[model samples]
Target: MIELVACDMAGTTIDEHGDVYVALARCVEEIGVETTPEAVQEWMGADKVEAITALIQAGGGAASPGIVAAAFTRFKELLVEFYAANPPVALDGVEEAFRTLRGQGVKVALTTGFSRDVAEHLLASLGWSVAAPGVEAGDPGKVLDAVVCSDEVPAGRPAPHMIHRAMERTGVQDVRAVIAAGDTVNDLAAANNAGVVAVGVLTGKLDREALAAHPHHHILDGVKDIPALLSFPN
Candidate 1:
């Protein structure tokens, strides 16, 4: 029996594309860097700093400490504004699945590549508050047994360390006791490394072809299949 469920926020739980694109593009313009949307898409599951580094490199711009800081600061400001302008939408049937999982005495945890601030802010914005009763919406922490942020990890995706950390803290020694759900190759890689069941959802920047290249046990059009995937048998 699966005792816990862990999920990636951006590109997985959070609707991928659109607002993020505009925010990054506007930030690029404001920071005086000419960039193309396709370049940004390529760096989709990476950390903010890594993305900035990649963006600068691809755009033929020099990566300086000062320039990097300026670019990230501008990106955060615009990204926050974009989130405020449009509400975060959780994927289909996710809330119901979470509720049912918790009811079955299963522990819920979240692991994401997003910084602590971004993760908390996004969850709060979307009402994923996970209180004792469970994540009713954006505030998911209150209900989840634990949360592992990228800042707390040695490395980002494609690394099992983050998932291992979450499992360690949650006291899940057996990989079979946990289910890792994500939307990117990095996500699948991390899950596979941690020896957990990997489930992929096509709610992110990657298309079916990209996702199929990885070792995902279940592939779905969206997160709507989470409940069924868990076999809650409703």
Candidate 2:
């Protein structure tokens, strides 16, 4: 039985409509690194600072600490402002899936590659936030068990820290009893690295072919199928 479900934000739970990539391209361009939405999609689950550094380096530019910091700060400012003006919407079936999982005694945690401030802005915009672990009573239909951000972990996706932090915070003792689902390869990689069931959903930027290239236990049409996956005997 899965005790917890670790989900990714943006493409996974929240529908950004390519805003993150747009902001990413604009931010890196300020530092002389020209990139495209397709390029930014490759770093979907990575920390923004690391992604910016890599993009700059790929463009034959030095990723100076100062430059990275400045670009990251600019990206955050742009993203927050963009979201404020055009708030993101939750993907179809997300709220229903979360409620279903909680009804079955599964903790639902939302993890993101974005920094804490950005994550908070997203949560606030959606009128959702991380509930304290072990809270006995709350609107299980609406509250999340935890929210893990890249800034809170030593590293982001493909490193397992975010998943580990979510598990730690939600009191999920066994990796076998966890399910990590997202719409990117990095999300699948991170779940594999963390030794949990890696589920790929086709609700985001990545296509079936791209997600199939990664290690995963199952690939679903969307996260709405997750609750069904949990209902099976393990």
Candidate 3:
């Protein structure tokens, strides 16, 4: 049985209308590095700094720390404004699924590639707070057991630090007891690196072909099917 589920935010849980890639592409372009949305998509589950670095490298520029930092700062500003202007919507059945998992003594944590500020902003818009099991605040429908972000760790997805941090914060020691779900290859790679179940969901930018090209344990139509995947008899 899965004791904890570490889910990705933008595509897997919250629907942000592809604003993340847009902001990333815009920021990189500002630095004279023209990039396509598909280029940014390749690093969807990575840290913004890492993503910016990749963009710089891809566009034949030196991905210095200074350049990555500058690009990322601008990306944060743009992303914050974009989300504020157009608040995101939760995926269908996400909240219900959280409640169901929590009710079954299973911990549910929302992990994201975005930094804490952006993550908190998105959570606040959804009326959710980042807290542990008993000290939750805000809309009960939107509460999660924990929230882990890329900035909190040394590295993000495909490195497994975020997943390890989520497990640490949630007090789950065994990797076999966790399941990581998201809409990109990076998410699956992270889970695979962490030695946990890697689940792919189709609600994000990548289609089945893209996701299938990566390593994963299972594929679901959407996160709503997670409960069934876990054999939760409700």
Best by lDDT: 3
Per residue, candidate 2 scores C-alpha lDDT tens digits across 1-234 of: 789899999888889776888888788998787776667888887888888988888777788999999999999988987887888988888877887777678998998889988988888878776656565325643568999989898888789989989889888889999999999888999999999999999998888888998889999988888977767321
Candidate 3 per-residue C-alpha lDDT over 39-143 given as tens digits, one digit per residue, 9 for 90 to 100: 888899888888889889999988988888888899989988888788799999888777777777778898898999888888888887655555432458545
| lDDT digits (tens) for residues 114-203 of candidate 1 | 678878888786666655434343444344667788778877777787788878877788998888888877788888888998888788
lDDT of each: 0.74, 0.85, 0.86
Model 2, residue 147: what's the lDDT? 90
Task: Flag clash pairs in model 2.
Answer: none
Stretches > 4 Å off in candidate 3: 134-142
RMSD of 2: 2.3
